[model samples]
Target chain A: QQPVQSPQAVILREGEDAVINCSSSKALYSVHWYRQKHGEAPVFLMILLKGGEQKGHEKISASFNEKKQQSSLYLTASQLSYSGTYFCGTLGGSNYKLTFGKGTLLTVNP
Target chain B: DAGITQSPRHKVTETGTPVTLRCHQTENHRYMYWYRQDPGHGLRLIHYSYGVKDTDKGEVSDGYSVSRSKTEDFLLTLESATSSQTSVYFCAITGDRGNTEAFFGQGTRLTVV
Candidate 1:
């Protein structure tokens, strides 16, 4: 099943902070975060594994709670470039398939 | 950026017609996925392929079919297109077993009239 993301949309002023949360009902092996700009492809941000290990782009960071089957993306000192739709993808037990959440639209105004 | 290319970046087809979108990757990633992005639905997986000739249906597989004849090519076909099927299609690839990040193609905007 697809994961659920909270706050369908949010508006932020430059340098403000925002957090996007993703929750999954089933156990997850890994959680991935990606950002998509308008009319562009989704770009990888970071990934959190079951063991609390995180690997991803240096500019973005996230946290994964294996016990709770949840993940949160932290955006600090947001900039206009941070404006976009953020999606969280989850990977279950064995397959390479990744399912994504509905997405959170974040608009950063200058 | 990952050597992934999607053909016919934009297409407009009539209802009940057959349309095919092609995804070609030079990365030779073992896993290839087809997803459709709608306004509120986000990106919904339509189908996926693990290897050549090894494909499986995803959550929203109805009215769609897929084929992977070679390691570098994966194709998604709409047997009979409909207005409801109009959306942006993305083709993504991952080299490892869910450990590495997926590389996505630019995407194909398909419109059914």
Candidate 2:
């Protein structure tokens, strides 16, 4: 099944912070985060393996809670370049397929 | 940037016609995947291959078929294109499971009339 993402869309001002959440009903072995611009393919941002770990990239950070089967992407001091759609991909069990969330559209204005 | 390339970046074909999208990877990754992106749906996996001749269906694999005859190439074919199949297709390659990031191609935008 596909994961669920909260806050379908968010608009933020420069230097503001926002959070996008993803939850899956099935047990997940890993959670992957990606950002896609208009009319472009999704680009990999980070991957959080099992064990409920957290990973960071500059002002963007993500946390995976294995127990809850949920993950959250945090954007701090947002930049205009961060204006795009964010998606969370989850892998579970023997499934090699990465089920993605409906996606969260983030618009950061300068 | 992982030497992944997708052919026919943009294509337009009539319904009921067969369309094939090819993905070539120079990185020699063992795992390759095909996904489609739509308006509301982020990216849905169509098919994936772990090795040559080893493939598996994804959630949205009904109308789409895929093949991986070589380590460096994977192909997605639409047996009979439909208007609903008109979307952007992406090809991705990963070196290993979990913990690793997959690199995506520019994508192929296919339109069916």
Candidate 3:
């Protein structure tokens, strides 16, 4: 099943912080975070394993909760470069394909 | 970043015509995938191949077929193009499942008229 993303869209000023949440209905093995700028392909951010470990890249971080079948991405001290659509790819229930959430549109203004 | 390249970066076709998109990777990754990105749906996997001649259907594989005859190439074909299939198609690769990060190609903008 496709994962669910909260706060379909969010606007933040530079230096502000924002959080994007993703949830799945099935037992998840991992959660992958990716950022896609307009007119470009999605770029890998970080991946959270099943043990609920937290991972970070620069000011971006994410946590995966296998038991709860959910994950959350936190972007702190946002910058204009952070403006993009964030997607969470999920692997769950012994599924071969990684499913993605609808995505959260983030706009960071100067 | 994985040296993955997709062919026919942009295309336009009439409805009911056949369309094929090619994905070539120089990384020799163990996995390759075809995904379609549409507004509000993010990217949905259409098909994936684990090894040469070994393929699997994804969440949204209807009307699409895939083949991986060579390790460096994976192809996605639409038997009959439809307007709903018009979207930016991306090819992704990963050395391992869930253990490694996946890299995507520039993408192919496909339009069905």
Q: How would you encode candidate 3's per-residue C-alpha lDDT over B21-97 as one tens digit per residue?
A: 99999998988999999987889888999899999999899999999999999999999999999999999998877
TM-score of each: 0.97, 0.96, 0.96
User: Quality of candidate 2's docking, in CAPRI categories?
Assistant: medium
How far off is residue B89 in model 1, in Å? Answer: 0.4
On DockQ, the candidate that comes out on top is: 1
- Report the number of the highest-TM-score candidate: 1
Per-residue lDDT of model 1, residues B2-111, tens digit only? 99999989999999999999999999899999999999999999999999999988889999999999999999999999999999999999987678899999999999
For residues A20-88, write the lDDT of model 2, one tens digit per residue.
Answer: 999999999999999999987788888898975645366688888889999999899899999999999
| Residues A1-110 of candidate 1: C-alpha lDDT, one tens digit per residue | 78999889999999999999999998899999999999999999998988878898776678899889999999999989999999999988867678899999999998
Q: Evaluated with lDDT, which candidate comes out highest? A: 1
The predicted structure with the larger DockQ, 1 or 3, is 1
Residue A99 of model 2 has an lDDT of 75
Give the CA lDDT, 0 to 100, for residue B32 in model 3: 91
How far is B32's C-alpha from truth in model 2 (Å)? Answer: 1.1
